[model samples]
Target: MESNSSPSSSPIPIFSTFTSPFEGSSKKSDLTKKPLSLWPGMYHSPVTLALWETRSNIFERLLDPPLDAPPQTELITKTPSRSRMTIMYNFSTDYLLREQYRDPWNEVRIGKLLEDLDALAGTISVKHCSDDDSTTRPLYLVTASVDKMVLKKPISVDVDLNIVGAVTWVGRSSIEIQLDVTQPATADATDSVALTANFIFVARDYKTGKAAPVNRLIPETEREKSLYEAAETRNQLRKRKFKDEKKELDNGEVDKFEELLAEGRIFCDMPALADRDSILLRDTRLENSLICQPQQRNIHGRIFGGFLMHRAFELAFSTAYTFAGMMPSFLEVDHVDFLRPVDVGNFLRFKSCVLYTECENPDHPLIHVEVVAHVTRPEFRSSEVSNRFYFTFTVRPEAKAMNNGRRIRKVVPATEEEAHRIVERMDADSL
Candidate 1:
């Protein structure tokens, strides 16, 4: 996507939204809520550190550019300086809970950013920082446009990013935040991995639970203007993309699934109201025929491991729940890999089937499911499986609340090396 300027670049200044409890001057301005409280432990390492980098970098790279106009160029005049800030401190990721690495959320990242903002706003303090000036409350919001992909072991795909965020029009309730993320290619890389987005955060005072006005005017800075332009360009591209995708969907060109199903095993089984339906889905024909579309052609043009897993999980759930007649609990999802990139318009196929289970523990019979999704282009119809995951599900026989009633296992996977290995691992994990 081309980097261009966005219209929402003006920055406002800060003003009070609440009457101090110590001073009873209760003239309510347009400010809606009390400033957030200064709390201990809120701005500690890891979370706070990530927040600091995310916010500071995003602000300097994104906001500063759009808010300020570029210096007028003259034949003899030199170009103007850009707004810039060096890294003052870096925090390790140790403070973040290990479980967070498994299921990361956008809100979690935002919370950390806000915590750092609270410290910068004079509502809080970093424990070890020497600079304790309590008067500076910086204005801006931070966000990420994540296009994640599941990868095979040992290899890593770094998300090289150029972030652009600016304080949009400030208001009584909030300041609109617009951001654009550009993932750059490395020295040896041939293509860019990127996504752009925008966010708006309303400043709130913790005491009154209301909105606060942003009156802080951002000084004109070259960095801010450049970032804003980038955002505008990204926005326009996104709009054009939506139109194109709509056209593709309307054409009824569902190419991948129908072809793969021809060569794959299909299952349509339903048992009485058993809550766990995973054990009965023993159809695995699509695994051998799956293929991954390359990144160049995918609509987003980026292969996100998480997005691929989500699709796999959705298909697994759809197949399993249809047979078991209950909401299946997501017991575990392990061994996810992005074997390849699935591009847009490429024919993609997915296959899911139960592996095996031990009847020794009757209530929770471990169910193993395998998935393979791949892509095939028009020129080269050679399909390759690009994604894989092993999912485990158990039956909840006691759940009468299940709408579909208790489901009982009707079939099991034929014993195989992978099947035996899965059961053995499940047995060990239970210990």
Candidate 2:
């Protein structure tokens, strides 16, 4: 998806309500409820969608979702600002086509769904931190829970049908969400598989990162709170681990898992210090060391600002993630300033720090990292913010293969801007 320009209050519409014929027929038109709003700003502009259509597997990520709920006919003047609601979805084409192939919108069409969700939750935070006190904010958490019918039959290639999704959240960092895939009405080849998902989000403090208490919770009303509580329970259930009674590691497997486990654990629980110890050291008033490379002049001899930015983000986050353990999610990135130019193949290294974290969310920790790339020939090196910018990362658990026997943890930044220059770069899901 193209970088969203800014959070706007424009209206976008979706259909969410459904009428049942014998209360058994399944179709987008049979949805029990219609979408709550129809704000144009909620939908992606034609230019953005057109650009994404050119990519592979990515086309599935931008599909439009079907709404069955009643559209909110009333127009309100209050539109909200943008929040950092990022989602990552992974899928196979046959599975997606089997479920939503004939539905029109296909693949990873989650960005817009998340954007609209943020609008419904009132004021939410998108950026990890605010300049005020250097505190972090909570973004809503989302998880998609697909029904069993689709889970039983994962679509494979040449089948023309597949299922693609993510346990994605695109609202306040504190809010949680889930999505599920379901089967079509009939098991016929012509029947288009129906696809829909549920969203649960909450508003949170921009600073002191806590869940702002619910001012109004109606027990009888089956609104967001009910869905949130249920999703939270389900999430907890999914996270449960059963001890392996007879699954002992064979000779070298234990040692290999230990090595990766130790490396990956840094991303989850890194300690802080001031003196130049390996992990956290302060140099001058800057906090940590950085390698600022001279501006790069391309291989063909032309200066490429793009290549420099990519390298800067990659090297900088590499250190932060290495310290955190897991592959970090790329969060946010400020614009860069290219002061001078350096030649191609000039070695560059980035120096950085674990600046004040997003104070609000202790669970979903946000590390503010900065980078200054320096050009290192056998002769010289310089350091400056002219090539400097910030990146955000959130710590998460590592995969079993990478974790070994120990509980492995790592960090993931949420935005491409924090690591990659391209807005359309594959997210953690693709990685």
Candidate 3:
């Protein structure tokens, strides 16, 4: 299948409902109001759909057996290098930004970028495992994690985005795809790397719902060797983290707050601390819930990871905007862990909060936002946490100065465990 020859020129309607999930008798004051114009374009934009369609075509080619292949062959075999894919999109200012904003790039637009990345990564995963030629027994792939995302600079609307994804490592069922986002050199600026991220995906048999094997990734070039080695290191770190989490659960060690406090770390009631330190986690939190629709499903009949990322980003942006009292520029997406796949028609609840904030000067403030996604069954009303996303943003100096150097509110952890988690995240961000 070929991608759309011409993308529609008209603007598309936003499909998401940007509203507070919390129910209350009293309305939030203007000081905490969400920006009315904070809208995402990926869900309904024709250009976005066209780009995704092109990606889908690539995926189809990767999975489909060659026409000349023997009819009796049960498995379709292809080299890993043949699975590599690249996509480029020319986004107009109107396509990405709200009409109220002068600049096209902002936290909301960054969310859209992340959404596209997730989609592309998921497609690559399916391609990597397409050796199975059984049409009736399809393979399903879901995003396992997104890590080591480095945002070199803010993406402007004036430049077209170039996204490249290639397989770097493959496990029995999991594969790592390194994605690089760049823009062509322009008259005003040289070609630059906008973002780089490593996305992990796991393949499963659609019928049995069990782990499926994928072709190994053989590195031939020196650059490929380095990427493969880096992926190995990251995989080790993920294992250690998972083991530690399991141990914590087994030991029933729920709170680490008291442990930090006992170690002479002052979590609260310090007058020397900045005024922003007094802000509670609840003060800068926001929640949004929606039912998954069929349109949001991928080829496997499950919710697309990119769609979930887009929704999560919007909530995080809202939380940061409400706390900072201004639009924030997206700096980095520290990590996103997808614990499990979400099925279509499941109700998803997104809870986002300002985890921490650092302000050295009134000119620039860094805000760390955490978002947790939960999937609930409509009948039982029981929910399981499905994903966790960490993002960093900075308030522009001009925006901060205009607000009279408004101090970005800090997250006040209610317990020692929460404090320790905050510190760990802070350290991770530094790396």
For each candidate in the order shown, give its overall lDDT on alpha carbons: 0.36, 0.33, 0.65
Question: How many collisions per candidate?
Answer: 56, 100, 4
lDDT of 3 by residue, 1-431 (tens): 01122232121222222222222426556246432222221233333343444443444433342434432224444433555666655444334333221244532266667776777677666666655454344466778888857677666655456677778888777889887877765565564667888888887665466787766677766777888888899899889876765333222223434443332233355535535344766567799999988677665566778888888887888888888898887777777888888887898999998888887765667889999999988699698999988988888888877888777765666666566667667656775
TM-score of each: 0.33, 0.28, 0.75
Window of ten residues with lowest summed lDDT in model 1: 123-132
Best by lDDT: 3
Q: Which candidate would rank higher by TM-score, 1 or 3?
A: 3
lDDT of 1 by residue, 1-431 (tens): 22333322122112111322224445564143332222111223322333333333332322122323332122121111111111111112322232232223211222222222222222111111111122332222211122121111111122212233434323343333433323345565544433222333344332233443334334345665665455456446545844763342222223322322222222323334332433323443333233334422211233423345556766665554554455444455553434554554556677776544444565555555566676756587586867665665555565424544443454433333333444444443353
How much is 303 displaced in model 3, in angstroms?
Answer: 1.0
Ten-residue segment with the worst summed lDDT in candidate 2? 141-150
Model 3 lDDT at residue 203: 75
**Where does candidate 3 have its weakest 10-residue lDDT segment?**
1-10
Give residue 137's error in model 2 in angstroms. Answer: 50
lDDT of 2 by residue, 341-393 (tens): 44445555555644334435434555555666555565554443335545555
